[model samples]
Target: MFLALKEVGQSKIRYTLISLIMIAILFLVFFITGLANGLSFADSSSLQNLKTDYIVTNEEADGAVINSTLSEDQLKTIEEQLNQQSTPFSLTISAVEDKQGKEVNVAYFSVDTEKYSDIEIIEGKNISELTGNEVIINENIKNHGYELNDIIVDKISDTPMKIAGFSKNQTYTFLPVIYADFDLGMSNIYGDEPSYNAVLYTGEKVDISGFDTLTKNEAVKSIPGYTETQGSLMMMVVFLFIISAFVSTVFFFIITIQKLNQFGILKAVGADTKYIAKSIFIQVILLTTIGLSLSGLAIYGITQLLPGEMPFKISPTLMLGTAGLFLVLNLLGSLLSVYKVAKIDALEAIGRVE
Candidate 1:
């Protein structure tokens, strides 16, 4: 360790350049990770906030809540079979014009407010308090210049709905969500059919002959594009990890070759191979540690400077997991150089028997 530190100190510029390169690579990984997480949250935050354990959808829908359709009779049967209260829910993609007459895309969700009551109202009352054409919208609506008591008109039906309140962090399918009374939302979308897209329930698993029961995790995974988007980002992350490992291996190998004569002298003077290997390992670990630390700090700082509208989030568990993977892979890559050091012959390296 002492010798490694001394050597690094002597080659400050080279080590610094390597650390900078590593920092750049890791920063990209962390930043992209944040983006992946943010996109996922945007895709499913509305459902996650429901805090329900199970979602009942039509078996034919194949785990897709958006594709599921449940009639009042079907919902009642499921409720009775499970002996639990259930909330009938439906969603539609619609455009709403803000107070300034600017149109914005929104996912309109309708549910029995009394049964669900899952949304957290940031500034005003819940959707249950909404009387005729009133609705509760996500706080993101405020960014578009709509606020409490503001009227937003549905582009399709030309129906003007009053924003009775605002909730925080409610999004669906990567769009801001508007929560409205089931009757009003159903009337606008279904014209008084008294039907819903799915049912939300809490408790142990319940098996209905014609319906599929999905956990929260399974439900999230079923969202369209959720799997594909996350999968692509993860592949990119893995590639970057492999590239970093390759860079570290090649860099360390070259450094070791350059110092072969010094290693040979140390070995001739009674230093064992194990001692030299330890020094190399310590150097690799130290470099990786410093690079990871700086990259983590950079991610935090950069995210703080980003605009609120940017869908970027940081999960501690994910960040730590990624960092741990990088460390392990880098160590493995550094082992190649360590192996070369072990093969260094004292006499040959010193030109005494070459």
Candidate 2:
């Protein structure tokens, strides 16, 4: 270990370049991990945080909330039979105008507002005040210059709007969320008769009998690209790492061959093959550690720069997995050099001089 660091310190420039390769590979691994998490969150934010066990939507819709609609009356029917509180899934509705004259696509959820416990008010009145004209938005939009009492204009029926308050960071289908009264929620999207996209079952699984009810995990898969996108990205992440391990192995093998005479001298002087192997392996671990640590910081900075819709999430478990993968890969790379070391001829270094 001491000699390895000593070698690194002496020719730091050359070693820096070698270490850079490790850094670049680790950076890519972490970056893809971030993308995987981000895309999943972006794809499932609608139902991920809901305090419900399952969602009830029209079976024909095949789990798509944005395209499905159920009448509020249907919601009432489901509620009456409930063992616990259920929420009407008021999703869909696009191209809303803020009274301030800006236009954006939005997802509006119509809850009884007074019923759910997770829908916290971070900056405005409780959802009970969300009426036909009053609306609640997320901090993400509010940070975009929209403030309390400001009107958001909507081209759909030229809906009149007022920011009654702001809520914590709750999002749906990757869009910044806007919560409103059930009547306003429907009027904003349907323009008339109000309805919900689905119903959320919170207690002892409201018996839908003939209707379909999906657990929270099952519901997110209905979001377009939710499963396939994550599956594809995850595949790419694995493929990239396999390539990296091979590349590192090849590079280390070449470096080992060039140092054969030196290794032979050490071996001839009583150093065992185990010592050489251990030294080579330690170098691999050190190189990968440096790369991955640097990339972790870089990925975090990049995540902060992205919008809420960008599904790049940071999970502690994932970081640990990434670190573990890097270490294993580098160990595999170092092991490849052992074959070359085993072939070194101790006699060659004795009197052979260039």
Candidate 3:
């Protein structure tokens, strides 16, 4: 163990270079991990914000928010059974026109003002005061140069919804979510009964035996391409993990091979294989630990510099999981060198036969 670390210290330049390479890979993996989480959150944040135990939507939409439509009668029956805060739901064409009248696509949420607890109004007035076509927009809307009291015009067949408030973290399908009163939103989107396609049920137990009750996650899956979107992002995360593992392993193996003469000398001096292997393992672990520690600090620094709307989130569990995976792969990589050390003949040192 002492010799391995000492050798690294002596060849500080090489070790530093290797650690930097590992650090770069770690940064990339962590970045991709953040992106995957961002994508997942964007798909489901609106449903999560509903603060409901269960989310019931159209099974036909296949987990898509825009595709599902449920009758108000279907909604009323569920509320009577589950004691829910039912809101008539429909998605409007998401066109947000900034102060300059330039447009960006977004997701519009039409919810109940009376049951506004299901959603929060961070800036400006609540739904109760919303009247005369007033509509509340998401924080993402505000970030795009629209501010309080800004007029929001939907570039569709329907009338424009007035922007009354700025909101927080309401996103779906990677688009920001804007909220409006059910009466106003439904009339604009559907124009009558069954106008609202899905129902957001807030309760402990939802009895959908007569009908189907889909949780928020299930509701999301009901949207076509929802799960596939998440699955693809996860595939990228897994790819980054593989890259991190293979790169670290190969580097360690090569370094060990280069140190063969030192291992042979130690073996001739009666060093135990167990002790030698342990040292190699210790060296690999130490190197990885230092690299991760630096990367952890770097991630924090980088996320701080990111724009608020960027889908970058920090999760300790994910960071720990990624680090642990690298640690195991690094140790596994040292196995080849450990085996090579074990086979070194002590007789080679003296050139003598027993």
Candidate 4:
């Protein structure tokens, strides 16, 4: 360990460059993972906030909440069969005009607020207090200059909906959501027969004949583009991690080769191969630790500077797990060099071979 530190101090520039490279690679991995998580959350925060065990959708809809259409009879049948309370809801994305007449895409959610009790109100009254023309919006809309008591016009019917309150972290498919009461007026707007997109229920198992039951996670995946987006970002993260390992292996291999003669001299003077290997291990550990720490800090600083609209979330647990994987891969990559050091012939490395 002492010798490894001495060498790193003597070769400050070279090690600094290597450390910088490691930092950059790890930063990209961390940032990409964070973005992937953020996108997933943004895509499904509305559903997640429901805190229900199962979402009942029409089987024909193929697990898509938006595409599912459940009639009053179907909802009642399921409720009767499962013997649990079910909240019928509808979700749609449409352009709505802000007070300034600027159109913005927002997800409109129609539900019986009294029955659906999982919503978290961050700054205003519960959804039950909202009238047909009154709505509760996600706080993210505040970024667009909308506030409590602001009037937003539904583009479809030109109905002015008042923002009665704000909810925290309720977004669907990356768009801010507005929760409105499923009154007779809103039901007429959707359809005359009173159909809902899906039903939210909490139960162990649902045996509805015509409807499909999905867990919360499954419902999230049913959102369009959610699965594909996450898959692509995760693939990139995996490839980057592989590349980092490869780079570390090559760099350490070259460093080990250059130090062959030094290892030979130490061995000739009474140092064992284990001692030499320990030094290499120490150097790899120090380098990886310093690089990952800096990368984490850099990610934190960058996220702080980003605009609120950008979907980027950093999970401490996920970051720590990623860092641990990176450290293990780096150490494994350096082992090739350690193997080389273990096989070093003192005489041959010192040019005493005849």
Model 4 lDDT vs. the true structure?
0.86
lDDT tens readout by residue for model 4, 84-157: 77788888677786656687888888888788774788887787676567888899988778888888887776
Index of the highest-TM-score prediction = 4
- lDDT at 218, model 1: 89
Q: Any idea what lDDT model 3 has?
A: 0.73
Q: What TM-score, to 2 decimals, does candidate 2 have?
A: 0.85
Candidates in order have lDDT scores of 0.85, 0.73, 0.73, 0.86
TM-score of each: 0.93, 0.85, 0.86, 0.96
Superior by lDDT: candidate 1 or candidate 2: 1
lDDT by residue for model 1 over 117-210, one digit each (tens)?
5468888778667688888888988888877888888888787888888998799886888888876754346465755778888888888889
Give Cα distance to truth, residue 213, candidate 4, Å.
Answer: 0.6
Off by over 4 Å in 2: 71-77, 98-100, 128-132, 185-188, 300-312, 315-317, 342-354
Best by lDDT: 4
Report RMSD (Å) for each prediction in the order shown: 1.9, 3.4, 3.0, 1.6
Better of 2 and 4 by TM-score: 4
Clashes of each: 0, 12, 11, 0
TM-score, predicted candidate 4 vs. hidden true structure:
0.96
Candidate 3 local lDDT, residue 164:
82
